[model samples]
Target: MSIVDALDRVCRRLDEIRACVRWAEAIVREGGSDAERRASNEIRAASFIAACGAMEQFFRAFVEWLCGEIGQSGLRYVEIRLSLHSIASSGDFRSLQSLRERDPMFGRRMDLLNRTVSTKSCSLKVPRDELGLGGETIRPGQVSNVWAVFGLPGSGFEDLGQEVAMRVLADSRNDYAHGRVDISTFLAHPECEPSRFLDRISALEEWCFHCWSAGLEYLDSQGYRR
Candidate 1:
């Protein structure tokens, strides 16, 4: 899928989470038993968790889409950024070493090295594992690292003004998931209210929109090519 499509999916997911938040709001507004009120707070907490999960999925999809686009762009090895070229050629050390061990004749090894150093036309599809998102939470540093893979500056999200929201969402999600904070404690925090959660999530949506636009602009300019 394209980055735009990924963004659309995330937006829809966030909207669903927002709906849950609204439902929780309704429960609070109406007179409710103690049990019902507690349930509503739990719903809000779940919504926050869902929002973080949605954002994580969006980033994963975006990176996968980017790799597919670079592969399809048909640009020569030399035309792309050096970091991408490195990933396309060397990949991880285990794979590279395995290839070397298998190539006693050195023919395959030499050929691979030549491809790396020369301006040969080759598949530039980066493997998802090479992108370094190994089941970790999506933080600002992770976002920056992903951008840096394509020669983009790590400060792009900061420039877009969503860094704090991204950090907060990731950290809060981690805390909740790890049981560092219970739902009641989470709700008790001043910034952890359902409304604040929605606002942070809205900022994330804006971040995704900017990323989509920027990805399209990069493709249009053939930024991957010389």
Candidate 2:
């Protein structure tokens, strides 16, 4: 396949993964029998987790191929790709440097994965989900490290876990590698104030819809539909 074709495929996959994540979020929101709810949650979470794995593979491979095509050195190419993409998405060029300062291990892996995934001898190991983010199959990978950045109320990665700036950014292993927007504001939106947790789940659903739409578009462009 042409490079464009490969990119098109990857984009479509990424979109699907995003939709799956959102789907899991939505299913978990609907009130139902305990068993039913658990089943739904498991399905959604499994789908999303699979999608995230595919995305990690896509990013690693895409960056490596692009780097090889452009003749960029392998050293830290993952970081460079992420930095550029992050800049495009977040409008913060400094986030790359800032993230670097935050954790050097992830920074380095990002760099290596970007360059390694395309080589004949290289492989991008998608991280597993030990956090029970979903069901059992969300095996960990180097990207698993980003979950630390997600920061819960008290611990893991971020030292100051205030709700004021609750970070909703995507983990490197997430389907949305560019990172998600701040969930705090969306969850707290007036429409969601009554049931904050449910609202957050709704936001996740919206995220899934966005991913689905984008993926469908990409697939349509490729003369495929689902």
TM-score of each: 0.84, 0.29
- Tens digits of lDDT, candidate 2, 85-184: 2212231323444554556646655654444333332122222232233222222232233223211122222222211111222231242222452343
Error of 1 at 160 (Å): 6.5
Model 2 misplaced stretches (Cα beyond 4 Å): 18-30, 70-226
lDDT, candidate 2, residue 19?
63
Find the 10 residues in a row with the least total lDDT in model 1: 152-161
